[model samples]
Target: MTIHRIVCAANRKRFTGQIVLGIRHWDLFMSEALDSEGDPVDQGFVDNRGNFLLRIEAWKVAEAAGQIIRRVGGDDTNGGTLYSENLY
Candidate 1:
């Protein structure tokens, strides 16, 4: 379990709160419950199954995607950007 300090969108207050980690749905509902991580919260945000909502690390998510993209010939590095302009 990890504690994350965050602000609430409903009331806009800052507070420290406990976050439940090691849950399966942590990745799925993270964005949804992230707004309630601050002070003035009456209860911990959770789903019907008691899974806490938290944010996923961006780098970790990117790293996982990179592995999959590489396997499918989706490497963006190999592709070059082209800037087009109309010459009048």
Candidate 2:
């Protein structure tokens, strides 16, 4: 989380907020919610109820962080050039 914060601070034009997903949670989700081909099941995102619930929680946290950023005048409307640097 701290690393993400620093990176986002350095590249504010791209990132807004970060959500830390644990490896165990991700593994559990992949083991249960995905098909053998690594694709989502017929139910898609909600194939695993636990993972879906955690995803919703993370989304809400990020949304709240975005609202706080907007209130503090840190929105994405700064009109700065985001891709001015050349890609290697």
Candidate 3:
């Protein structure tokens, strides 16, 4: 079983709506699933008016039968603020 650890980061945009901070990063990743050659995969995720819905958050997702999944970071609502806040 190949466990994929998806680590995502978030930042406040100057002009935009509200995001849970966690789902935003995942949404970006889903829309841009890349391979080794550095190409576009067309994640096929909808914008939904800027509402990011997480698989785990929704308690439902598509995955293999025995896949070890884990969401390291993303949502910072309940004291889950990002690990690092310095990215330049």
In lDDT terms, which candidate is top? 3
TM-score of candidate 1 against the unseen true structure: 0.18
**CA lDDT, candidate 3, residue 43:** 15
Q: List the residue pairs that clash in candidate 3.
A: 22-74, 22-75
TM-score, ranked from best to worst: 2, 1, 3
State the lDDT of candidate 1 residue by residue for 5-88, as single tens digits.
222111112365445332222343443555544445322223233443222222222333332222222233324111111000
lDDT of 2 at 20: 26
User: How far does residue 49 in candidate 2 sit from its true spot (Å)?
Assistant: 23
List of clashing residue pairs for candidate 2 = none
> How would you encode candidate 3's per-residue C-alpha lDDT over 1-74 as one tens digit per residue?
44322233333332342232433444555334322443322111112234332433222211222222444453
- Backbone clash pairs for candidate 1 read 15-39
Best by TM-score: 2
Candidate 1 has its poorest 10 consecutive residues by lDDT at 79-88
TM-score of each: 0.18, 0.19, 0.18
Please identify which of the two predictions, 2 or 3, would achieve the higher TM-score against the true structure.
2
